[model samples]
Target: MLVTLEGLDGSGKTTVWERLRSDDMVPDETVFTREPTDTWYGDAVQRSIDDDDADSLAELFLYTADHAAHLSNTVRPALEENRLVVSDRYSDSRYAYQGATLADSEMLDDPLSYVREVHAPWTRPPDRTVYLDLDPETAAKRSGATNKFETADYLATVRDNYERLIEADPERFVRVDATADPDTVYERVRDAIV
Candidate 1:
């Protein structure tokens, strides 16, 4: 089973994923990973994230390359061996974040759809996705507004994209409120997964 944890930065995705990875409740052989992965492709993505003037389209491709490499190098093999796979962030993040980035560019009339279509043919869809729900302002504050992607205004657009994703595939997404205390949020995420 491929279970993905997704949300805006500081929505507690990495924190929850870390705890879940160590929790006794999960399977011992479960495979935990994230994207952009810890590869050179990921390094490039990180650089792009730091570049305030990076082209939206270029950034999207960087994310796509990382996802492809991640699948080939990790996700596919783990699933083939019947291990439970959990990712902190996956393709959805690209679709949401990059979609928002390109929204005002006028290069693509439907940025979200375009991003999804780019990955539709090759990406492996998660069996389930846990969306940590939080307001954009709170998410920005929690994330420290560190980069272009962490701002409240931008996160709001990303949130809208996420909502569209959920609406399109309601069955695959499990929504969890992130406003609760850390322990409560962790418990909720654990329950949703287990």
Candidate 2:
């Protein structure tokens, strides 16, 4: 099972992942990994994140490269061995973040479709995705970074993109109200996945 937790930074994904990891129900073979993986491509993506002038398309491609490397090096191997895989972020982040940022650019008519099309060839979608929904103001406050995509307005657009992705395939997502305490949020995520 490839389970992924998706939300804005400081939306408690790490906290929830820790709780899930410590829970007794999780299998021993479960392998935990995250995007912007520990690779050259991932390094590029991280660097690009802090670059104010970075092109949206460049960021998208960087993320895509990191994703491909992460899948081949981590996710696929774990799955091949019959172990469950839990990831921090995945295709949805690409669609949400990049789609929102690219929306105003002359890159493509539909940034969402462009992202989706680019990722169509990647194998294995998450068995389940938990989207911790929170207002942009709260999420922004929770996250202290002042990176290019950390603004409230940008996050709001990203949330809208996330909503569209969820609407496009409702069954694949478990929406959780993330304004509650960390333990409470984990409870929702636990319930959703269990």
Candidate 3:
């Protein structure tokens, strides 16, 4: 099973992911990963987070490259061997952030179509996506202002986009209230997985 968690920063995804991983609830060999993965492309993506040198389009391409590398190197291989794979984030984020960035540009008409034409050949969609839903105010309180992208306003927009994405593809997404305690969140996620 390929399970991907989606949410704005500080939505408790990492905390819940850690709990699930440490509890050994998935399997001994379950491959866990995060986008902006530890690769050269990922490095470029990370740098774009704060550095103003690159524009949003550049950031989008960097993230796409990282996803390509991640798919070829980690996700594909693990799935081929029948190991469960869990990711902290995935392509949905690119669509949300980049779509928002491109909102003022011509690409806003069909951001997903653009991404599909450009990156879909190498990427694989997650079998299930769990979006940890939270208010931007609460999420900001949990995650400090470290990046320009983590603002409450942007997060709120991200949340809205996430919901729209979920609505657009109901079968793949499971929205969970993230304001609950970690244990409660983990239990809900576990039940969803089972």
Query: Which candidate tops lDDT?
Result: 1
Which parts of model 2 have CA positions greater than 4 angstroms off?
none
- Clashes in each model (backbone N, CA, C under 3 Å)? 0, 0, 0
Task: Pull out the clashing pairs in model 3.
Answer: none
Compared to the true structure, candidate 1 yields what TM-score? 0.98
The estimated TM-scores of all candidates read 0.98, 0.95, 0.92
Which of 1 and 2 is the better model by lDDT? 1
Q: List, residue by residue over 152-188, the lDDT tens digit for candidate 1.
A: 9999999999999999999999999999999999998
128-170: candidate 2 lDDT, tens digit per residue: 9999998888888888756777778899999999999899989
TM-score ranking, high to low: 1, 2, 3
Better of 1 and 2 by TM-score: 1
Question: Quick one: how many clashes does candidate 3 have?
Answer: 0
Candidate 2's displacement at residue 86, Å, is: 0.7
Candidate 3 wrongly placed segments (more than 4 Å): none
147 in model 3: Cα distance from truth in Å?
A: 0.4
